[model samples]
Target: MNRTTRLQQITVTLLSAGLLTLSGWGAAASPVQAAAASVAAPACGTGDHGLLQDLQKAHSGADSIPLSFSDVEFLNTNIGRAAGNGFLIGTSDGGCHFQKIYEGQWSFQQIDFPDNVHGWALAAVKDGQAKYLLRTADGGSTWTRLSNQAVTFERVEFLDSSQGFGYNRASTYYTKDGGESWSLIKTPANTRGAAFTSRSNGWAVVIVPGSGYRVMKTTDGGAAWKQVLKSSTSDPIYGQISANDSQVYALLYGDSGMSQTSYSLYGSSNSGGSWTRVIAQETAGGGPAPGSGAAVAKKGPASGTPGNMVLIGKTTAFLAGYQPAAEEVGVGLTKNNGRTWSNQKAVPGFEGVISFTDHNRGWLAARDLNSSTLYVTKDAGATWTARFSFETAGR
Candidate 1:
């Protein structure tokens, strides 16, 4: 009676009849948290995107930031890690790497917090002529450029250190003290995602002169901005805007069936007055590999489950959309919310590329088409355990 006990007895009788237990499989192993790797509760039971902390919202219901597993941490990336709901905040670089995820190993502590690791930004040079602005608080590693005074930056936001905001092509700039100096409040404004959850109010999901997708608010941080949800419909493109006022989460996408290409998502309990879709339209099998328009992983495994999308932290709401880069496919979790799941398995020799923290814990690295078996799971996603070894032929 194996195959994980006949898929847990057909998923406890189809989750007692409420239906949809393992749909097309979210991950697999089954029971006893799949028997080890540290899962106290989710074995398809569940996992990664970090922060699951034994998850308990059982079907997306009431999760507006109560996450504080010691304020959560994990960061040991040397190859860019963040495509969905990716904003670890607090900056990194000059010494500021705290990405802690246990069980499979991925703990980058590197601390020296001294705020504003040389803040800078002034954009617009993708050929629109000239104009640049990009300063990293350590996360982007290294980048500096203080001026060009908003030529075509599209968008840049900061609400700490001194204060910040930048939007080129349409125009808007305001620095309070940290960016050295800057001023200007308007020009064209066609932004798609901006955040400053604090320092006044801050929020942006722009494109307001007749385009669509608008929800611009500012208490003082950006100095002034107030359009609050105004999208008549210009094809949908509301990138992201994490929240704090009770709860808010927004990451939108559009233009996906051809080269004009564009997609990146999430939509929270929503904010202001309208807009409520909540992660959908994830068409995997490959999307970001033709000129680098950037957008893939919308339900990998050949477009199933409506092309799934998963994001677990930075204002956890379980929003999802596109995530199939096909290293054979990976993403599984079940801390009891979706009832049962396990065995969408792959880690025999390893080729999954997973990562996690705050719920049982998880991590897996090595992405060179194969030959990277590093594993660890603490049961929130139920089970796994492999430990050491590395090489994409080297490293």
Candidate 2:
């Protein structure tokens, strides 16, 4: 009775039963791209096995095989979904074209899509120490492997299709039935990231072995949590957490020494109860630290912040970073939720992962280490365009 009032009574019962509309793509065509090109092939048979096989090969001529996507989700602007390395691609029309809805050898890292046809992934299993949890209703074609026990959760958040929340650094998992079953809550000792707006409301970013970061919260859900926010000392702070309904964001960074590295972004429109730093620390550099003999600090302007953030509504938010000496990519926008911040228009690559499905569509995944590229923006990040690319060892 408080998931935003049951999602505003399920969007007023889907606009009084008309099923709530508003979808476009020029000429008459696009029922979610004709139901995603009518199931873009997802039935790989080889005695299938766990992790939902399918997608044996063919990502484009020449055996396309170099992917490094860690995450990407666009339930709009022409269906979209992406996962890392081992594959789990999809696209109807928006990002040029993408296929292969599932594959394995292990590697999903993170993915969550609370709605638009349920989704959730976290796999890792490739001798990577095990971790699994994959699910997809109809949007990503096919995927099913709820849990075989090893749960590490690099990060995942959902608030629909039956609640969700998972974090890393050892534990923190919860599912309210949509994940088939999962529950190991009671987090706090180093939980790397977490974000939730309902299912009782939540937030996390702990890491205090010697005292460095904290930003816990919960409201009758994760059993119990408190520590509003911390980290004014202890030097090793690093953080992450993002939310939209009831707002809630946290970034945090550390190491502000001669080599720089001080970021901070905090906001909370109630879900977290109280918080407001927006963006403060703002520093960035990584050119000297191999020896501790720092020197070569003559860059005088263009500091940095926005390590990465996404919250396309609830006042709007979008932040990205990667300005290694202005090579490109450095946006840091905010509509009002963060008081003020503006400097859009600077896309290129290497922002890793970012997503937005509102305030004018968005997507970015510029991984590196061989290949991984995909960018798009309608006018929100000011500008950007580069649909797809994933090549390695075939180049």
Candidate 3:
């Protein structure tokens, strides 16, 4: 059997063995239809700074702050997908700090990492250019600068501490001995995003410059690749690609008009050869509501287009977003792969990113004028409780 097929079999076996549980918020309750009232901010004492506050403080007097706290990446270990075990690379004026959260509490220790380091993949600056790959085996406490390469990497993915892949502006690269060395993987230009199920099976989304996007799959690591799906003029495709062991999901977006922004969710069971449109909706841009004075646009899905998504299984997934029409943040649940969707209760505040540990438990990062907080949901997004609140630091 091929590596992809074997990996799928192993995943099925693990799930059957109860090694993995597929539970998340709203796994049992009905779909929510209305927005949940905004809750009061939790009382936090001194020394309870949030990730954003730290970033703001770090670049307080700088001419420009290129990084936003909302854009900071949080790495969730696969062993405990969302049970409060995660890592965040904190940045501030001083330097970088590795923050680890265990059981809902955060412990931080500063490290000698560079600023603007995003996600688990690290990069080093040489003469104002990011030129080398770096890895940290001991969480984010320390990093070993890998041998320098002639590529300016923009994104990197590590399946484990040692093995991983990275891509520059127009090329793909891989490394097996951590980031110490890397070899180029020939692929089409304009490749933007990639995900690998194993060393030999993976997929990437390549944009055709002024045209649209296409999905590419690799079976022998990144050494070889083939185009599996291409966007046509009739149905233009544009969005990011995310995958698991057996399936790949794409959150596509299209601009119809100021009053007709389109969003769609597509899934592929056989890599990227074909896709099924699981959910489709059109966002009514800022305009008169239906039956008002102007032309009434199509109503958006009950659940707004989520900026992020977390797939629990082949058929189960959760999407959450802050709806401008309703002026609230809400979540939607789909058990049959987007054929049908149920809107969960909306919560007040802008939901930045959503992560789930299982099918029944997850966490959300929310931001408001006064503070940024992390909310935890135990009932699969049916309800939420504020777990941590960080006061926005003053300018």
lDDT, candidates in the order shown: 0.36, 0.60, 0.48
What digit string (tens of lDDT, one per residue) describes model 3 on residues 1-395? 00111010001011222221212111221223111112222332223234445544544564522222232222221111111111343211111112222111121111111112211443334123344454544334444455555346655666544566665445667777766677877665667666666678877777665566677888887777898766532334345566776567765555544424465556666566666666556444522211112211132233454565666666667666665444466666666655566666766564455666456666666565555556667787889776555554353
Which candidate number has the best TM-score?
3
lDDT tens per residue, model 1, 140-173: 3344455545445454445554676654333456
| Tens-digit per-residue lDDT, 1-395, candidate 2 | 11111110011011232221222211233456445345444332222222122242334436445556777877666666777767776654555445556666767877776555567787776437677888876644566777667765666677778877666654667778887877777766777776666666677788765556788888877788898877554554557777766678777665554434565567776666776666554343432111112122212112443455777656777766654444455556666676666666665444456676677678877654445666788877677676665554444
Model 2 quality (TM-score): 0.29
A best-first ranking of the candidates according to their lDDT comes to 2, 3, 1
TM-score against truth, every candidate: 0.24, 0.29, 0.59
Q: Which candidate gets the maximum lDDT versus the true structure? A: 2
TM-score of 3: 0.59
Off by over 4 Å in 1: 1-173, 176-187, 190-237, 241-251, 254-297, 300-395
